[model samples]
Each structure stands twice: as C-alpha cells, then as structure tokens.
Target: MQSSYLLTLLLFAVNAFAVSLPIRIVSWNVRFDADASTRQDGEKPWSTILCGIWSERCRKPHVIELLKNEAANTASPTIIGLQEVLDNQLEDIKGGLGSTWQHIGFGRDDGKKAGEYSPILYNTDALTLVFSEMKWLSPTPDEVSFGWGAGSRRVVTIGVFEHKATGKRFIHANTHLDNVSSEARSEGIKVVASRIKAVREQFGPLGATLTGDFNSEPNQDAYQTLEDMDFLTEVSKSEAVKIRNLDLTYTGFESEAGFSRIDFVWFGPTEQHFYAAQSWEVVNNVVDGVFISDHRLVVADLTAL
Candidate 1:
C-alpha cells in the first residue's frame, strides 16, 4: 500500500513538471524573395549551389517544413522571427504553414506594402497575442522615416504573447539593422532597448527575447552597446559548441570562412527574469546542396525562471 502511494506521488510530480515546458523561439532570415525569375546579379554565380539543379525557387517549401517540424516538437509552441521577407514571400509562408499560424508586422517602407518586413509568426493554438506594434529604428520612430545614418528605413516588430495553457506571458522583439552604416547599427540597438523597456513598463514584468540579423560582428560598437547595457545576454554564450565549424552567420553561397557571425538570438533583462540558456545551434539547412538562405538560422532553446 505504501509503495502504491509513493508511485502515485512520483507520477504526479512528473506530470506537473511536464506541464511547465520551456518555450521555443526561433530567429531566421529567410533571404527574401529572390527566386529564379527574380534572380539578381550577385545570385547568378551561386545558382549551382541549389538543391534542385537550376532550382532557385524551392527554398520556401523547405523553410516551411522546418517551421512545421519546430512547432510539432515543442509542447509550448514555437515563435519565429523572420527578416528580409517580402509581401509575396509572407503570403507563401502563411499559405504553406496553414491557418493555425498567424504573424504580426508591417512593411518598413510605409507600414503597408512598400519595403521588406521583419515579422513575427506564432502558433495561434499555443499562444495568444496580447499586444503587438512596429517601431522604426529612427529618431522620429513614430514616422516612417530613416534616422541616424541608415541607408534604408529599418523597423522592429514587438509582440507580447501569453501561453494558452499556462497563462505565462513574454515579450518578443525582432529587427534587422542597417547593413552599411555603423552609426545606424549602434543607434538602432539603443532604440530597440528603449522600446523593450517601454513595452515592459506597459505590460508589467515579462521575460523578453530579442532576435535579429544585426549585420555586425561581435566586437563591433553595436554589440558593445548591447553588452554595456547589461540587460540582454546572447544565448550562444552559455552553450558549449559541439562542432567548431564556421561561426559565420552569412555564408553568401561561397566556401570562404571570412564571413562574420551577424545573426543572433538574445534573451534577458536577466535581473527581472531568470533565463536558463539551454542549447544554441546555427542550423545548416543546406540539404543535398540546396541552401535555405544566405544566412543560417540561429536557434536557441531557453527556459524562463
């Protein structure tokens, strides 16, 4: 009788633990909508690197499949932040993923359909979108104008989500900084931090995750600004790399190892929420010689404490 009672207690504990699973958030730059028909000058030489011989338009299907698998594996559905996505590409992603998935964000050009978008996609079944907004990385963030030394208009997509089963809430922000201007990249992060703080103030204490393709290296001023703030921490710092492969995030379809690690998945305001960094991976989605994007998706698994 005592053994039976002990078994029941153990089972209950296990079940309780299983109910509180960590959320999986992914950050990927889908390389925009540059297919065969729309191939530019730079992509011409790299045509041979694709999976299907002379097939430059098949990456969307692979990307969709990868996202589907991510959603299937996690108990607490996956939230994806995508950059460099055009309007048509967004439609393709949404159609491929089905109605269960929904996204929030707008075009950077006019907040409509002019420029690329840095959008966030969530599983509607597992998460409820409480609030969402888009802010530009400019001095006058409210207006659709570029600031600092930006070459083009850049914006950040912010979403506050609540877990359907657990009622747990968190904030997710995604962006892509200016590629050419160092001033833009540096000032852009500061703007992001301010926005994150504002959202936290409005939504109460919530764990935050910021993901993006910064287009700057770790040692640059932009990264240093984030470090100096001491609020956010890169997820890659905690994980022990299994394979010391090319750390570059932007491969550009070349075999060269000189590319910088520009992509990142960050979680923090560590003092507010205890974040246990689980694993970090630079997913090489180049299957059978086909590349998913020029940039590898940087995925991190984290548990909020």
Candidate 2:
C-alpha cells in the first residue's frame, strides 16, 4: 500500500514538471483612424476626417466579435498586445470583454492633450501586471511629436507580468512602426530593437516577446535589421511552408491581388524551444465581399523554453 502511494506521488510530480507553459497572444492594429473623430465635440477637422475613414472602413461590431472569438478559441490568452487602439475604443473593448481582461496603453500621437493611444490587454485571472510604461521611438524620448513623420505619431507599450499560477514572469513589448518612409521604418526598428535588447539584458535572455503591426514585411530591410540584432525571430520563417502560404494580413481597403505580410510576432533567439511559429488571417466579415481594416490579427503558440 505504501509503495502504491509513493508511486502515485512520483507520477504526479513528473506530470507537473513536464507540463508545457502555454501562452497565446494576439496583435492587431485596429485602424487608429476609426476613433479619431470620437474626441471632444468640435475636435480638429483632420481628426474628424480620420474618424470618418475609420467608420467607413473598420467594422467595430465585427472586430469585437473577433476578439471574443479569439478569447474563446484559445480559452483566453494571457496577453493581448494591440496597436492603433484609441482610448475610447479601449473602453468599448473593456465593456465587451467583461471584467476578466485588464489593459494598459497610452497615446503617442497627441499625448494627454488628445486621447488616442495603443493598449496591451491581458486576462487578469491568468497574469498580473508587474510594471507598465509607454515611450516614444524618437531619439528624444521625452518628445510627443511624430518620431519621424511615420504617419501621425507612434509609441511602444511595454509590460511585465507574472503568471498567477506558476509565478513565471515575462515581458511583452508592443508597437506600430512607420508605414510610409523607409528611413522612419529603419529608425523605428533600431529603437524597438534596442529596447528589446535592454529588456533581455536586464531580465535575462528568453524572458520576453514582441508583437505588433511593424508595417514592414518579412522580406523587408527593417525586419532584417531586427534579425541581425538577434532580438527577434520572425515566427513565419520557422513555420511550415504550407502554413506560410496563407493569405497575407493587410488588404488595402478593397480586395486586391497583392497584400503585404506586415503584421508580425517576434521572439528572441534565446527562445528556440518555442518553435513551429505560425500566423492566421482572421477573415470574418467583408464589405461587398471585400475585407476590413487593411490588416488582420496574427497569432502564434509557443512552447516555453
């Protein structure tokens, strides 16, 4: 009888040690232009025009449904890093997502003067925020202006969280890079790469993940710069060809033949154990059969190192 009890305890211990630490993350640029007009009444005309573009192009109801679907499909992700989300939209998402998900974000565009921002949302039940901060990509971190004229303004949101159950901690960095100028994109990549390196240096290797709509494709030079820095692993490259062949994430308003794979989820090289990286296009609704938001949500599952 004693032998049976000992054997059972041994098995339980082994099972506990062998269990995989699974984390699901979703990155989406919700089209910042959509909420531009929601500012105080009589906001700037430029902001109104931006909001109008968003309303016409972005399907908020469909997006909320997509978020709910992702949460349900994954049984809820520990962390969700989002870009181009305005303050008002974050509130709407909170209402829709219920009290389970907690979020942190700040606007890089106009700062407190205006209310736009990018937010990182996480399941409060699974992870607790340890630290959070927002910083610009410009050489001058204190400035609020568009870092390099890379479309309005941009900023990166960083958060460190501890797994409520296992006590394991990891950092998640989210950002939206310049979409227009190659120089801006290149500079933005360096700034973010430097930030990631600094985090790993302080937190130890393999202790972080970076996700966002970088606005640069896998084959682009900006992405290559990151690869050279050894700061991130483009999940798609490690994934199988069959999986990589899926439709690209960004479709310019109208359905066109060529779409770019600009959205990405990257992990440091130290995180090699987490393999078989993959991405999916969450195509739910279409206008006249044309997709919404020039971009799609890309997700990947990784085995903890």
Candidate 3:
C-alpha cells in the first residue's frame, strides 16, 4: 500500500510539472540564395558564397515539403521565428504549411528592393500578435549595408505575442548576424543583447526566445557575448534534451566536405516553462545532387515556463 501511494505521488508530480507551460517555438535561417530563377535576372547573390548556375527546374515544392515535414514533426509550435526569407517566400511557406500559421515582418533593407529580411510566423490559433518592429544591425540604422562588414545584408525582427487562451505574453526575436566581418558580428551581438535587456526592463518579466542563424560558431566571441549577457540560454546545451544533426548545416551543393553548425535557438529567464528543444537539417531534399539551401533548418520545442 505504501508503494502504491508513492507511485501515485510521483505520477501526480509529473502531471503537475507538465501543465505549467503553454507555448512551443521553432526557429531557423533558410539560406538566402535558394531560388535558382533569380540567378538569371543578373541580380547579385544574396548569400556570401558563390551561387552556381541557375537550375531551370523549380525546387520550391521540395523546400516547402521539407518545412511542412518539420512542422508536422513538432508538437505544434505556437510561434516560429524565421530569418533570410523574401517577402514572397513567406507566402510560399504559408501555403506549404497550410492555414495554421500567420506571419508578420517588414523589409528592413530599402523597402524590400534589395537584400533579404527576417520574419516571424506564428500559429494563429495559439498566439496573437500584439506588436512588432524591424531594425537594422549597422550604423546606418535604416540603410541596407551588411553592418558587420559581411558580404551580405542582415536585419533583426521582433514580435510580441499574447496567448489567446492563457493570456500569457512572450517576445520572439529573430536575426541573421554578419557572416564576413568579425567586427560587424560582434557589434550585432551587442546590439541584440542591449535591445533584449531594454525590452525586459520596460515590459517586465515574460518568456522570451531569440532564434536565428548567427554565422559564427559556438565558441566564437560573438556567441559568447550573448551568453554572458544573461539574455538567453542555448537550447542545444540543455541536459533534458538530446538534439540530432550536430555537424555542419551548410552543405555546399554536392560537396561532401561542406557543413557548418551555425544555426541556433535560445531562450531567456522564462525558459523553464519549456520542456524540450532541438535542431534539424533537412538533408533529404537534394535535387540532382544539389541541396535546397546551403543551410539547414534549426527547430526547437517549448512547453511554457
């Protein structure tokens, strides 16, 4: 009888722990130069690397399918923060994922005339957008310069969402730091940390998640700055979860040696509400020996804290 009582207490504890949270998040940086059709237009490559010849065949369907598969695999993320997506590309992603997601973002680089922008997509049924803003990472502020002396331009998009059912609020920030200039990357990290600090101070304690493709590796100064700021905890390092795809996410076409695990997802003080987090690279969508993007999708799951 004592053993039965102890077992019942343990089960109750597990159930109580599970009901404490109410949100899940997914974050990724889809490579900018994924479209082959744009190559023929004589436009400069969005990526830092050399973009090969354009393929006449469309890879959008395959790319969309992979995104859908990622979403389907998760326990229904309440919010998804994405970077490197074009204005029209969001439509494609929404179409692929069906009616469950609604998105918000602005063209931070010259009103969408050039360069890629970061965007956030959320499950409409789970969360409602309360506020959103876009800002540049360079000295020019509104200009399109790749602030970190990077070979490409980058921006950060932030969204505040309110849970429709629980009324709980959380902020999500998404960005792609400079890939070329070490200085720019460092400056970008500082900018992000400052902004998050300011947000928390003004808005009070709330759950927050920052997701993006930070270009630099884990041990780099850029990543270390953010870590020291107490702004976030790297989900990849969590003890409760074991995420796969630990190698290079950047696959250079058919090149076997090409890979870099530069993508990441992070959480702030309210992160304890989440139960799990992870990342994945869609390696199966290669077409004729070429990959859908140079980078893979990084995903994470959170319950609530």
Candidate 4:
C-alpha cells in the first residue's frame, strides 16, 4: 500500500513541476448575420424570419451552447479566437458564456462597436490578461484603415496572458484576413507576423500563438508568406497533425461537398516553442440538425515543452 501511494505522489509531483499547464485554444469564423435582403443561399439569419413557426429558438443559442460545451469538455484552461463577430453578436456571446469569460479586442471599423471583430476570448479563472491591443493589417498598422487594395479594413488582436497555474506567460493573436483580394490576404498575414517581433521586443521572448481565418489555403500566397517567416509555424502542417480532421473548417453553410480549409491554429518561435501541439480537432458545425456557423471550429491541445 505504501509503494502504491508513493507512485501516485511521484506522478503528481512530476506534473506539478511542469512550466505551464496544457491549454485548449479554439479558432472559429462564425458567419455574419446579413441583412434580410442580402441573405445568401444556404445561409440562415441569426434570428428567425417567422418567429413563432421556427422549430428551434434561434441560431444564437447553438453558437452559445457550442462554446459552453466546448469549455466544459476539459478541466484545462481555454481561450478562443473568433472571426466575423459583430458588435451585437459579441454582446450575445459574452452574455451567454456567463461571467467566467472575458475578451480582448474591439470592432474593426471604428475600433469601437462598428464592425466585425477578430476577438480573443479567455477564461478569467485560468489566465490573467497582461496586455492587449488591436492593430490594422496594414503597413501603417497603428492606424485603422484599409491597406494593399483590400476592400474592407482588417485587424488583428494581440494579447499577452499569464497562466495562473504555472506563472508562465505567452501571447495570443487573432485575425481575419481579406476574402476579396489575394494581395490583401498576403500582406495581412505579414503584418500579423511582424507583430510577433514587436511583441518579443516588449515582452522579451514569450511564446506566441495565433488563431485566425487566413482565407488563403495551404497553397496560397498568404500561407506561404507566413511560412517563409520561419518562426511562426502552422500546427496543421507540422508532424503534430497526429489526428486527422474529418472535414475542412469552412463549411459554407449547407454545402456538404465543398468546404474549404481556411481557419488555422498556430504556435511559434519554432526554436523555443512553449506550447507543443498534442492533438487537433476540427469540431463539427452541425448540432441537432442545425449548422451553428458556416465555418466549423478548430481546437488544438497544446502542452508546455
């Protein structure tokens, strides 16, 4: 009996000696709720057109429930990077996620409550927010404006977090690249990559993880541009592709046949990676016969090295 007790204590001691606890980071692009006249095929409005006749409550609940269930799946701390979130939708999600959740990022339009936000949501009980900032995906990143012939303004939200369990610090940046111009998508990721250097200069070599909808595929210019940066490595392209994802992250609503793989979860400074990828999952978008979002969420489990 003493031998068994000693073995259990040894295991716990080893785990406690680790630098940082394992964390789950989720990246998703929830489709925006378009105007009544602008709704596309297979795309459903967030609210019901006919309130009483609709079978389910609304699209909002499924999205809320999805995050809630995802958070409950593991005891480890969780943080999420989301794209295509409007001001009102942010309010809905924050309220639905309850008091334990907090986020860092603002709307992309006026830098307040105007447009879409590539927000990073974190669990307050597990991590402390050290610093947070939102920057445009432009040569002049400090200004909130369009760049590289992009139709709309794009932005990235970067946050430094301290793991409460281990007292270690790391960075998380989130963004949504342009879907219209390939040039914009290409330049946008470069700006996001540059933030890595800026972050290191200020924070001094903390590991950085980025989650976003690149819009560019693995073969595209933007993905290649970021790859050439060399320090920030994509997890899916690495040997850590331990578990195969059944479907691509972007579903495009009801189309079961043609989803694209645009969403990504990445960890960096390849030489001194803080979080090593353990497993990857492209979570299903559909629930109870309803699609939660046009794009499915991607979750990655990262363990401290």
Q: In TM-score terms, which candidate is top?
A: 4
What global local distance difference test value does model 4 have? 0.83
What is the per-residue lDDT of model 3 for residues 242-296, given as tens digits with 9 covering 90 to 100?
A: 4553456555455444567677778866334433433333243355554565566
What are the lDDT scores of the predictions, listed in order? Answer: 0.79, 0.65, 0.65, 0.83
List model 4 lDDT by residue over 71-128, tens digit each: 8898878889999999888888889898988999998999998899999999889899
Q: Model 2, 160-179: lDDT tens per residue?
A: 77676655667788988877
Residues 1-305 of candidate 1: C-alpha lDDT, one tens digit per residue? 99999998778644533444487778888887765787643443222346355444357667777777766766756889999988987887887788988999999999988789999998898889999999999998988989788898999999998777666678999999999799999999999999999999998777899999998888987788887899898876755242335567887754444377888888888565546677777777564465667787777777765
Q: Give all TM-scores, in the order shown.
A: 0.85, 0.78, 0.77, 0.89
Listed per candidate, the RMSD to the true structure in angstroms reads 6.7, 6.7, 8.5, 6.2
Residue 300 lDDT, candidate 4, scale 0-100: 84
lDDT of 1 at 290: 57
Q: Sorted on TM-score, highest at the top, how do the candidates line up?
A: 4, 1, 2, 3
Backbone clash count, each prediction separately = 1, 0, 6, 0
CA lDDT for candidate 2: 0.65
Best by lDDT: 4
